[model samples]
Target: MIKTIKHFTISSLLYGLLFTSCDLDRLPMEGPSTGNFPANEQEAILGLNGAYQSISTLDAASTPIWHVMDNITDVGYARPGNNYTSPITSSVTTDNALATKPWQYHYRTIARVHLVLDNLSNLETSMDEGSYLQLAAELRFVRAYCYSQLIELYGNVPLLRHAVGLDNADVPRTPKAEIQQFILDEMSEIAEHLPINQSAYGHVRASRIAAYMLKARVALYAKRYAVAAEAAKKGLEYAEGIHDLTSFNATIDVAGKDHRAGEPDVSNIFGHEGYANSAEWIWVAEYSIAAGNTHNRQYYGASRLGKGVCYWGPTQNFIDSFQALDGLPIDESPLYDAQRPFENRDPRLDLYCVRPASRFMGYQFQPQTEHRTVFNYWPVNNGSSSEPSSVTNTDATNAYRSFSGYLWRKHLDLNDFNSTSVSGESELNVGIFRLAELFLIYAEAKIEANELDGSVYSAINKIRQRAHMPPLTEGLTQQQLRSALRYERKIELANDGLRWYDLRRWGIATDVMNGYLYLNRAGNGWSTNTLQYIDENHNPVYNHNEATKHFTTQTVIYKENKDEYWPIPASEMDANKQLIQNPGY
Candidate 1:
């Protein structure tokens, strides 16, 4: 004889309520309404789908944003050779148009999960136990992933667990350390519930192994060396017997497409065609051109080589780090010639970048060829507010102008070489997490925890051995081992957007960034005339030289500070009044 409330929508009511309320009705009850779900079961499933959908959005793993984040560290640079200008710096810090996308997207996702968890208690059927567990686990994983991204981009974000309607939007910031711990705890729990084989759910969904991999990555960023090592080992174990390394040539092919079928190959590691489900990938952000959803290849790859978007160059320091084919450092290589810098470096350098004098797409690159500099444009003016004119023709005179002195090749589809069409329809799944990264993570953790013996060498040697390079010599000290680990990471993960974060976590960004900024200018012989040239109209034209004078030797230096963390977006600050800002914003 419970009192019935007609005003409550059937969708909002629990399964028990629906059964009891409609028991007297002779006719069959309609399924849950469009606005509501049967109870905890349906809603919970919806919640999990919502979380996965959030990941599918471009912003989560957008290549353009990833490029921006990666280039700021030691390995990459923005246009006008030796210039310090790029759109990323302008937008990422201050209130700019592009910054809003990442800030908004991440919070929107977190909010969806919060709503799901808040209403979990309303689920009615005991029969829904399996569904509930799976939903809860997936939601927790998504929440942890989002929070980690937020913390990395903007430190000290408000950790919201409950759904807050518009009226109560203002929540205070949580301590970074607390947030980190919470994420670790949530991921650890979710890992236990997730399935080892996600074949039923497909590669797009997070599985038990993905959770473990994420846990290791989070632990590493938190600087918990022992925990990081343990978690990384678990992730490695889960991935073991799952994927075998593809041959060098095959890996190169997978770099071109984003479909997976048949046995795993090297290209499979990269989400290329016939390789999306390869064992190498621990987590991936899926994209479909048919869905009208794609990454911003036009921004990263369009330059003079293709459509003339912007080409961010690589630093000399990065180039120098590549070992010669014989496993010798470039500086130490007998084949090394300072004048002919591009010759005899690691094969990866050639594979990853389109440098001067390199052959690409059946053409030997000349400093003055259409094909040579086609993909080398930078978004910002190297010196001033004036924008550079786009190169309409691929003639020799415009060839070097199109070159940023470097080209990005990783995660790009070379087959899609038409410069006139500037959309990223080419199918190449952007991998968010992969096994190669985990291997380096294990190596780093072992070294940090003083476990760098044969096991550590073995882990490091695997990556080196794959690159067809020699293994590390035995009996090295901790410092030497550390150097070797760092070098391995740089070569393997370069242009994959991990270097900047690696430098920050390793506490070397300030020194390395400052040193490179100095050397690029010095080596380029920056002067009034250095960056200037005559215009096509035969008029004397000035480049970024005037603005270059503003940056003294001192302007290039940065102190590694707590402020290394980016500021929380202003919109978030306003929405969550309770949220605290990081210090020195």
Candidate 2:
């Protein structure tokens, strides 16, 4: 018996309340004593709620930390700041907020998990066996999740099984493999006890499928291909009708009459309505303005014209990674036109990203300085009778406009446009897992294990079809299928916080990250001849000799051993004398 709890009704929206505070200065365990506080079922639920809240802390920008993570990777760029720059430049110090917050917050969650886990036996008499098992399983799932993120970001971390007092706070770092095995075993042990769908609990909590999916994802990250394949296959089989990709074909306000790109709006899936309606989300970190548990994603992610400062956007390298309309790289496909680049490109380019000459947030989103004013179609009285009128093109003329000349449109909801401000109070929920990602995980795991089959192609094609891209041809070589899978993950999972991990796990982080990150600050188009070739990973390689003269570029630095894992924070190393630092830190 791990721990026991008393009976109480768990709220459907458990994490909407203020976060439980614990003393975490010297170690994760120095907090309110977990022994007697959670004497009943409601306290246990509150303790568990704290654990979930710990993982979803927002940054100084009030953006979800997960959404802000990818901005420092090769796929995206962010406004100039030490928090964003240090990681990309590989100059991160142990005290850097970005590096330290995860270390601190995850351990804080582990602390909260231990609060209930250490004393569940107390309620074993009052709670039924099934209820007890489910409660313990959910607690363990959160602990496993915290460790999964820890091992990926920090390599080896302290594996605290229970809360410790200040006197016994010091603990040595565990081996990465040992912690990974713990996560796999914990997830496997708890999966049978969890429900397949947590819809009754607002879908924010872990379910049976979410457990297996987490297991699969951890196994895949650890390169245990067989284990990953088995777990992912089990999860997919369990998810048959309960979960599937949300369609974008619905009539959404993403496009206007003048827009040339086909309307493939994803706002219905990534916006407020998605959390309320879409079944694609497996696990979500829920937030609400009315509930006072919200973030400023709309304010940070929206463009200047949309009332945001444009803190982050995709890099030109990422923009060029989108395949042409014919399902081929732009360098190889004749359908690509340099002059009219937006046309005949992947609809995702227009759907997921806001580039020049496109309509976004009821405004023409041209970033070139020549356009001091652009057309706004937003109705005067917020009615349907409004006419298009010229408005100041802050996206083009503002000094603090988008640096990469593009804005992420994937999670930005037009419905939130009117409320976009510096308050950081947007109610959009960020997705942690989805059916499409599970399909990609299963496909990649099978391909890596040399287990070629129809299932692999079907998994990959399902995601492509949703994006309106052509289905993959039958009988592609293992290497070719690998490329196809990589393409989908890069494009489909762009700003969802997986690219940094994907680059490192695939052993291509060094090659892709240790070069110039090209930018088109003016939203200017370049010649097709500037494209040198597409790499094995489907990343576009450009002729820097000519590109340097036309586009502004940022230098990226990534050392081999040193950059693989973020350094154990200097504060942690000092706080725990038994802990040793990672390489080159």
Give the winner by TM-score. Answer: 2
In candidate 2, stretches whose alpha carbon ends up further than 4 angstroms from where it belongs are 1-21, 24-29, 58-60, 250-264, 384-386
**Positional deviation of residue 148's Cα in model 2 after best superposition, in angstroms:** 0.5
lDDT of 1 at 220: 85
Question: Can you give the TM-score per candidate against the true fold?
Answer: 0.76, 0.94
Candidate 2 lDDT tens digits, 1-585? 110011112342453332333464346535546657567777777767666656666455788877887898988999988888889898998888888888887887787788788998788887888878888899999999989999999998888888877778898889989998999999889999999998765567889999999999999999999999999999999899999898875543333223333233576688767776788989887665444566888888888878888999999898889888789998888988877776677777877887888777777888998988888767542676656778988898888899998889888787787777776477677788899899999999999998989999999888888877899999899999999999999998889889999999999989998889998889887887777988879898989998876689999999999988998888778778988998988
Cα lDDT computed for each candidate against the true fold? 0.56, 0.81
Candidate 1 C-alpha lDDT tens digits along 1-585: 111111112332332232334211111111112223325476566555655555545342235455555565556665432223422232234353344455566666676566566566566355366656666787788878888887776777777776555555566677778999998888887787787656454455677878887888888889888888888888778777874454365444322121121111233344254244456666665554443445665445533435444455565445556766676664346775655555565666766765544433323333433332332222221343233234333423443333234555565554444422444454355666777788888888888888876878988888787766788989988887888888888878876777767767777655554532421322222343322332221112224345245222212344455436655656556645676765555
Clash tally, candidates in order: 32, 5
Global fold similarity of model 2 (TM-score): 0.94
